[model samples]
Target chain A: MNTAMLLLTYAVVLGAVAPAMLQRASWVERAPRLAMAAWRSLTVAVPGAALLAGLTMVVPASPLGAPLARALDACVMMMQDSYATPQRVLIIMVALLLSVAIITRVAYGVGVELGRAWWERRRHMAVLRMVARRDVRLDVLVVHHRAAIAYCLPGRGGSIVLSSSALSALGDRRLAAVLAHERAHLRGRHHLLTATARGLRRAFPLITLFATAEREIDRLAELAADDAAVHASDRLTVADALLTLADDHVLPGPALGTTPHDTGQRVRRLLKRTPPLHPVVTLVIALLAWTAMAAPLVAAAMPAVATIGVDCCPTR
Target chain B: MRGFGELEAAIMDVMWAAEAALPVREVLNRLRPDREPAFTTVQTVMDILYRKGWVDRRLEGRGYRYWATAGRDDYVAGLMSSALKSSPDRAAALARFVERMNPAEVEELRAALEAARTGEPPP
Candidate 1:
């Protein structure tokens, strides 16, 4: 019965509650970094909850309300029972399979994504080394292309790439702003975060929580990078640079360029200048995020403890 | 070190400028007529260049004759495009800049750029 309840909790969280909560959580845009943390925690928590639900059944029900050692003995006895009903054994097998499947899927997805990113970065580095001219003053690579595009390839030896057209198009101030924006992406390692989110989404495409988290995290990464860019260059300059490069499509790969999905919205955000979230509010949100992560573990553990207590000491 | 290392670039430059495909011996001869690199060294660098898809080689008599697959400008342009194409999944990568914006937004951007240029406050 407790196992059923735990499974139900996992289903409700992954299916209904998470999608609804994330949809309504519009304020996430105000504090993207915190929101990203919360979303990532929620993504991890769903699978964690499922694993916990499966583990609960492995622990045998204790009817005597006994001590920990006695309850553990009862669990072992239940496991060793040759006469154990086929139905119960089947349930245990299914639970074990489900937990293992979820874990394997997530791990495989992350590994594939990391490997692909690594490979793409290597190829891009080689290509950049061969073609791009280093501009020491701007600390960027200038590619002699007619199209106006600017982006940064992320990694240790990664570089900011700007097309010759982009250099000619933007004024000095806007150019600086664009440089700052690309620098922010590199400094923050936004590509890795986006790639991780992509991996999780690939692992659990059917789960609304992972899908929504992936999209939100991608958007918020851009917003957070914009915030960082604003520090070095004024709002208008950054906005102008965004507009100038607005038509340029980054070469499809691991490059994290300044071309956000919603340029108008980002531009408006820059104009309004929403202040950063207060430290206390950020702290509270962080605490809530941690609590959410811990909830599934506590939920899964409580039933096992209760079962142990019931078997160890019936009278109490 | 645009794409190729110094030695690789020298090889590529020689091949690109050559009127016809050059064997390793001829490439080495043209690269440095005075000191002259070893035949094997030129062969190795040319092989690396071939593997990297910068040049194509054909069997000419006993040895391989190599030629630049693309002009230097075209190669540089291709590199620029490839750098942009770094995303693992092209379909799901971030939206292109102009595709996301409408005509009205384009006008707004123009206004913003104009305002920035004139030092006028955004209206």
Candidate 2:
């Protein structure tokens, strides 16, 4: 396989091992979103950088490209036979790794700085606005505007500010429904997803799929929040609030419910959802994933895998 | 005051109308003479009111003086306005809230919004 494929495989190996080893039970429940995000990252950002680093190493360490190397070596033989030296491969790999590291560090710093600044600006404005405090202290700050929705901002105290517009827009019944939707985001701590998406993007800038996954998971988070709002109040009121908010033109603030895809798409899903995965199905899926993930390790530990495989395959 | 429950709203209405805090006895005296409540009941209600963060009390000699923590109109206005600001789709949510309200309630919301927009008391 090309270096890119190999590196992507390596990354998948690392990524899979981490969650399987360290993931909590709740995290397993959230796997659909995380899995989609991982797949998206793989497609969008991983391949190109891995290819760059892998090619740099593979091209030089092995004598496989003799024709190409010899031709290039001849041109520089008089002055610098050193041009085709195997050390170039090592240098290239190191340089690629260094470049990736520096770029990631810079991008992460900038993204964090920008997110913090944006949230800080919102905090100042939010304090001046008067709103009723909900009973639970979820590190959420709600400011009422015209939209009947909720959203979370990532970083720092990441408050979910609502609008006076949304409050007065929804009747008390619907308003309670909407507030529950926002509260769900705080409870689930979906801001962590934003951070994950941001980290993946920073690390693997080329992955378009990661962005799609991030956006989709963000939308799904909204669906989950809608379900929460439904639980807190009437399903119809929450559904109506979602519909009304979908028609709203207000731009989302730094926190959660402000995006176009999140509002409309989320409401639609909430209205149509069958119950989420049954506990048994979810457990089985979790077990199956972990088992599939561990199969390679099991095979590696047991040299009898060939015989076992042969017996299982049975000449077919 | 117009749409309030008995003792709690009445106390607030008195506090809002008065320029200064009133003693429990004075507040009790001001109520219609035919409908006198037990002084202790008034006092208890006032205490409950204070606990709801609706009123502030200061001890004076053997008794206490009570005043509203927020004006009746201001508290309702604040509640309404704050609700509007807390969601993502505020304007539409608010518009829907307004649209779904009964005529009288819609009128009040409209008046509130207009007053808020113009920075004036509702006429």
Candidate 3:
């Protein structure tokens, strides 16, 4: 019971407040890869801790070390003995149902999200093979369109796509930067991260953390990829490539997506090239991320360890 | 790197290039593969395309003639229109890089997108 409360408190505080704090942090703009790691860790850890808390309530945490069958038998006996009253039994049942419900929703949401993406990509790849020709010089799929465009279709046999006009518009340095950006996305497997974010948002639409994580991951991932582009060409050149594409498109429009600011930010971030966090700061951040993931698992296990020690080495 | 996937694409190219439906034998002769693809292989691939609804086929003169279901340009146009839409597309198939500035202009861009997709506005 104490273990359950401890975990629940951690989950509540982390889930309710961390996203707001993270979003406002200026340091993330300087250390985007770290930001991505933080978000991914939060996604796994928060819900996980909640689920474990629920499980701790559903079953009595008796000492574990006997054979599997005997251990489960002891657990079941403890659950029945401790929850003798109707109200307590009902509470335990509710916790079990809630845990199962969360598990089901997450599984279904992720399955549908990932499955839908895979199907759409397969269909797109087939049509792309028919329509776009592989460019010999650049080795990218080229569509003969005037709108300056560049993107990557990521997954199995992933390929970068560039519009013919983008080809004509980007000079050597900018083109190299652009290619590196798209390549970084593919190499880092950003799509899986994105798809999982989308899935979690779908599963938990009302949760501010999941919603914020989805947007933040999408935003920070671009920054992370831009950092990769810095290796191929200077940051200013990458900024130029962004502006060139923005200028090339003649369309005046108002879909002002919730995140066109991300593009604006990307360009600004490149122009000012903030130095990465110091190694010690980065290491400290890494340790914090590890703690967020590991703490719940340890908390959940502590009950079992306590029970085991009491049973095996009785104090005089 | 190109394998059966490239062959499928090559065969589609042949169908798209033709003015009218052509028999499997003609497709085989027209194919410029690194190595010659057998008549049976061409027929099998065209059958696959027909099954996939990428091609329309008719049986005439003891062989089937196949033509593309839609013009190559139309397919590319549809793809461009959807791909150009700003982020978090339902499928999220394309990780696009068109970014930044000028908010009031989006209304015009939407209309331009619709017009370009419908009309044969080749860039």
DockQ of all models, two decimals each:
0.24, 0.03, 0.25
Best by lDDT: 3
Q: What share of the true interface contacts does each candidate keep?
A: 0.17, 0.00, 0.43
lDDT of 2 at A157: 45
Writing each residue's lDDT as its tens digit, candidate 3 over A43-97 gives 8888888888888887656223233224555545655576898988887898788
Q: Please report the interface RMSD of model 3 to 1 decimal.
A: 8.4
What is the lDDT, from 0 to 100, of the residue A4 in candidate 2? 35
lDDT of 1 by residue, A1-316 (tens): 4754666586565656765676577667678778878887777777777766765665444222223534466545644662288988888788778778888888988777766777766776666666666799999888788777777777777788887888888879878887777777788777777777778888887876777777777677777777666778777667777777764443333323334345677777776657778899889989988877788777765655775556434554
Best by TM-score: 3
Residues A135-154 of candidate 2: C-alpha lDDT, one tens digit per residue? 24443344434344443443
User: Which candidate order results from sorting by DockQ in descending order?
Assistant: 3, 1, 2
True lDDT of residue A74, candidate 3: 51
Per-residue lDDT of model 2, residues B1-123, tens digit only? 111235665666667777889898888887656467778878887888778686799999998999988764565445444433534223211111111222343244344434443563322
Deviating ranges (above 4 Å) for candidate 3: A62-79, A250-255, A311-313, B32-35, B100-123
Deviation in angstroms for A99 in model 2? 8.4
- TM-score between model 2 and native: 0.44
Deviation in angstroms for A115 in model 1? 3.2
Error of 1 at B78 (Å): 4.4
